[model samples]
Target: MISLLFGAGASFGAELHKPVPPLGNYLFDKLVELGGAFAELPDDIKQEFRLHGFEKGMLSIPNDSRVINPLQKEIAKYLSSFKPSNENAYVRLFRSLREYAKHVNVITLNYDLLIEHAMLMSGAQKVSYGIDANEKSYSVLKVHGSANFVPVLAPNIIFEGNVSIGCGAFIETNQIRSLNSHEEIIKWCDSRQNSDLSPIMCMYNKEKRVVINPKYLESKRKDYTGVISNTRTLIIVGVKYIEHDNHIWDVILDSAPELIIVDPYPSEEFLLLLKQRNITHTLIRDSFYKSVLKLSLHIRSRVKIDPQI
Candidate 1:
């Protein structure tokens, strides 16, 4: 068994005409709309926004906690409303990948619906969440709470309620408002002190804050453990390996499977880091879609299965 992991960059091929709005822009626009002022901004605010892909002068106010909180909520709402255009390149890529990995598992950090859509398009008979012990077909694990999964709230506890086409499992309306609440949002600014159960909200500037359900985190870890221990090869695509996602890297390194990395241009630093971790079986490719297709064909040709009577 082999598993595949995908990141936001993989969604880029989905052919969204408007680049998914970077976190910084989403935060900035909302802050200005809410009357958040520059003078009230935190000293490190400008630098933070820049990391998420915001230029300093791009927005009117200084990007700081005071301004960013509400902006994040607005951004979440905006993201909730985003519908993929009909002609999506990512859709085709996802379909191709799904067909290629007929017997494998896929884990993605992306919150978008492209992968799900692709699976549906491919006429896949089954898709499992990695939670079931007996599932045997293709599966997808959205590590980060997806945009199409809604959470059910019960006092201090939250659980996955339903999976809708456009809703996410981790981000509740109340959660978004809580994150936007200037007073409550401060609790998450220090990543170390934050609860791991909370869904992690990331700004384009690379700053990450946890805002997930603890239960979900446990489920994710358990599922990951099962997949990693069983899978023989791991393919990583479109992930930028940001510092916030160090935990994922740790898991991959610990798994020590045959590793393959696919990206248009992989950085030397990333390669060095992988090397330092002693992940020797790495393959870099120019096109993730193409690589996955080729790999699948090769695997299918090599494996032989008996037809049951």
Candidate 2:
């Protein structure tokens, strides 16, 4: 099976119209510019952050409890605020994938719903999360979580501490976040008073998207782990390797499939790491949309050469 793993960079073209950079960088840059306790963070953290550059500053903020909630909101808003363009080649790009690679799946590290919106806009029969399926269409396994996802309450389950929504609850994908058919989710969430009803957004492996879960829940991981392990070709877009995402890194190393990385500014350190691990990868030094278009052209040519394919 083919898997598409996207990072914040995947949404750069869409978010640029918002007049800011990708969601993660915008938040991190804002926080950094604020110049308070955030600026006073350890030198070790700051030093490591310098290696990844601005776009990756989001990774530095995830573990720090003070910024997780704000980070989540910024990510969600940046994602939901932007509507996918009919003219966007990515919509066509993904549509082609669904048509060509019937068994394709998407694993996004981003909290944004851009992929979901694009798929829905392209008239997909179903855009499922994790194990849930319509069987007729594609699935997206959000390793972090989604902005529209909601918590599933369990009455019999008992938990005493750190329940962001309510005790004994787990997150489930909400089919819709917009109140109107044409309204965007960011607008919908902004107008709503009860933001808690929305799924919590965070970076860790947990049920809540809003905070770091110490529980390390297995059910939370089962679907993504299963999907990733079987990935024959993994297309990674705009991700800078970071320590917080070690689990994701583990999967990538273990899968070690045909790798395609999309980033205009690729990391040399990351390239060295990949080389050390002996993982073969094709580095596409272009923006997400353009790189996808290039790959799409190659696939189209192959399809033409073999009519049976």
Candidate 3:
């Protein structure tokens, strides 16, 4: 079966005019709102948010600082609060795809609830989020965790192992910044270990804590690997090929599936990289929503001819 993998850009067309903020802007605004010192912050840091890509902005966060760590937490909080409306163009596209596919699985790296909202609006009677033993209809796997998901809390900092810093404060690793506190929680989410860490968490409840555990990492790894092993065709939307996310490239390399990449302005380096890897990919120099619409027509025409055989 074919799998649809979505990047943040896939939903950008719909969110262009909406109140939803990008990662860089979201983080920067939250930091300033939380009474952090943004006045002395470097110009480069502000510019980082304006970058055309997601990874560049996300990775710009400092690794071992309390400021960035807390900022990560705030970012997760912001995403959770982002309520998606059904009026967006991408939402309509999602509805159309669901109606056509009927039983196909969708895997998305975006943290937004655009896909989920679309599914609900489309009247898909049966829908599953992750690995479901009894699910038979369509499913959506948010590889990077979604803003709507509430993660399970763990006791005594499970994954990071209780380590204290010289300042007498506990130090959390970057992985903690990526996953929740409980390993089992992430396992339940079916997030891939090698997948880019999505910052989605439930921070509204004052009593709820975050857990990032081994099971979570393993689950994420398993989901990604399973998709790579099983999928025959992969449609990548709104994702730019960045060096930091080479793990995705690795999956593409190993899977050797027919790839269709949809982007408005693709880089020459990305095209060169695909050629270098000997991976076959069709670059659509158009909006993802438009490309998907065109692809859907072709897919339907092809499906119509199957019964004649």
lDDT of 1 at 108: 80
lDDT of the structure predicted as candidate 3: 0.53
lDDT of candidate 1 over 1-309, digit per residue (tens): 767787765665444364452333454554445453433455466455545445343243333333443444433444443334445544454454443455567788765555655555555555555533122244578665554343334455532232222222334333321232222333433233222222234433333332334355446656777787776787777777664555567677677777777777776777887788787666656554446555554445433543121
Mark the 10 consecutive residues where model 1 has the least summed lDDT. 159-168
Best prediction by TM-score: 2
- Residues 1-309, candidate 3, lDDT per residue (tens digit)? 566777757776445456653533344555556554332346676576456333354445443333333444444444445545666655665555554554345787666666665665665665566644122255677655555444333444333223222322222233333232234333433343312222343111121112323344346556876876677777778776665564456777677777777778776887887788788777778775457566565345433333221
Which of the numbered candidates is closest to the native, going by highest lDDT? Answer: 2
Ranking by lDDT: 2, 3, 1
Clashing pairs in 2: 200-209, 200-210, 201-209, 201-210, 202-209
lDDT of each: 0.51, 0.57, 0.53
RMSD of 2: 6.6
Model 1 has how many clashing residue pairs?
Answer: 20
Lowest lDDT block of 10, candidate 3:
202-211
